[model samples]
Target: MSDWLHNLPVPMMALVIFGFTYFLAALVFVAVALAATEERAKSLKAISPGMLPVLGIIFGLFVAFTAAQVWGDSDRAGAAVSREASALRSAVLLAAGLPAEQETKLRGLVRDYVGQAVAEEWPMMAHQEASLKATPPALADALKLVVTMMPQGRAQETSQREIVAALEQALDARRQRIIVSLASVNSVKWWCLYLQALCELLVIGFVHCDNRLGSAIAMGLFATGVATSVLLIAAHDRPFTGQISISPEPLRQIMPEAPTGHS
Candidate 1:
């Protein structure tokens, strides 16, 4: 699936997939039907219908394998965002254990990080342009501030340790999300899926070549299934790129009032 198709709205996406699939099916029906002579029709009818079930099974497996990766990426992307948000919230709470001035500064740093993530990093991730080379400055500063501060008491010492841990977790979660954002169904798998589907379509044409009406009906129904399966999988193939993408709302929820520049 191309980025242009994935980026389309759901209804438009469906129309394109369904329309293209039906067109291909019609072409197959016409080619087979017109080419079938009386003697050839007898041979075509003799072609085992049993092969149809086998081809259908193979096509189903292709869809299953492809869909598994797509759905898994979506699930992982969601989990990573949620974990990052949870870690940031924990750090904010732990910041309270510091002195008023230090705690305020620490909270401010967290806000800045979240704000930048929502405004800048998100768009980059959407296009798979985000890189690990770009370490978030705010998080780096917060880590520095927390690690350098001398704990005045047991409570402060605990807060310092926990806040550091929280920040680390947040960083890890961010890394996970960015890595998952880069995941997509590779071209080889896509080719395999389509080729298998084409094989099935050809088998439908072969087995029903003697009867144009039966051929048309079988191809239409199968094409619809193939198109719908493909549309559903392709829409989510690149978890971060599509209209069904994971949003930065989890990060935004951390500091709704934080000043954000451009998304």
Candidate 2:
């Protein structure tokens, strides 16, 4: 089912699903309204046709809000990844301040970590799991050595403090990247999409009752609108999947020689 849904030309699929569902809903609503009118013919029933316009306005607003949220989420994910890559690069450069051997080891660790994320974590992001692990023990060990090398004077204390600060920043960046990547899936957005879909169906149904030709046109319009919205939301929601997904280009550029392993 998932594959089938994913395989459809997104725009067309969205239209077909929304149009059929809404048309059915309109039929049911018209039937009920007609039944009620028949039951109270002597009471002079007056239907408020204005409600349709109001519904359309509400639907438009809801769709706009969802689109904004999806776009925001996509932007945030991209920014977070970029920030992480920058932090990693900065950390690698700072490692040069350490003793020669320690610097080489730290740089290697950073390269390995970036490589693992690109090769492993990236591919599995769509699946919501990261299997490859590039341990930070090597980096930690280098930091420990740097701290020990500090002399008993004020300069040593100051240098040690700087090293600690850089390490902390790198670790924080790494944590942020992981958290943001994991949170790429916005379930609440999905629910909102579902509600918007329901409302769209209701609107289509209302049109169906007023005029058959008009209803068909409305269905076409509604289908196209809803499908476009869903496609936009899905593209952003799974920012790591599909052709429009965010690329790990920054990581690639940073660790050119790093091993490509799962995570």
Candidate 3:
């Protein structure tokens, strides 16, 4: 069910589901209002003057909530990319302290990792892969060797410990980047919020139907509002998929060449 929902084309899905829901709600509202009018036509000859203001307040609150969620998700996705890039850059600089051959090998692995993340992992994340195959076994081996090659003395050991710490930090950052990328998809809350928006639109339509604002004005407002919300949600959910996504330029710029000696 989740996969089916995610695979839906954005505009069509929003229109079909939200539109149908709003239609049902509007029908119900109209039916109830008609029944009330017939039952008390003589005694209660007036529509509630407070209905518009009440609906407006409710709609405003709903819009604000949706906006806040979208904004929060957008910021998180952007921060994740920045944090991952900073960690990768620091790891690359730290690799310079290793022996020349080790340095070369480690840098190569880092470069490959970045490239694979940009080119391959971004796509796989949409399918909900926890992490990418960026750090191969060879890279892990090189990291282990860096730990083993520390000189035997308190001062040198301390420096080695710092290097190890940095390496660990880098690995953690990489994992976090992958996790955030995969997890940024809209949560169940998003669906519920969308449903609420549709309900609000239906209520709006029923309340204003007597004003005779014409179908175009009514639909235009509802469609525009709903589409904007969905687009914002989808963009944040798959930050790396669309044109507005966080670019891989930072990683690409720092990509190192493959080292010699590895077959």
Which stretches in model 3 have alpha-carbon errors above 4 Å? Answer: 1-49, 132-139, 152-159, 184-191, 214-216, 259-263
- What is candidate 1's TM-score against the reference? 0.94
Q: List RMSD in Å for every model shown.
A: 3.4, 5.9, 5.0
- The TM-score leader among the candidates is 1
Question: TM-scores for all candidates?
Answer: 0.94, 0.70, 0.69
Over 4 Å off, model 1 = 256-263
- Collision pairs in model 2: 26-205, 120-262, 120-263, 132-262
**Cα lDDT of all candidates, in order?**
0.88, 0.59, 0.59
Better of 1 and 3 by TM-score: 1
Q: What is the lDDT of residue 5 in candidate 2?
A: 41
lDDT of 3: 0.59
| Regions more than 4 Å wrong, model 2 | 1-46, 130-163, 184-210, 256-263
**Candidate 2 structure quality by residue, lDDT tens digits, 1-263:** 13234335556556665665556545645553464344543332244446556766776777687777657766776876777677666666665565666556666776766666677767666454542255356446646766767445665465556666765665665555555555443556556655665655555544344455665666566656665666666555555555566788987776625434876
Q: What lDDT is obtained when candidate 1 is compared to the true structure?
A: 0.88
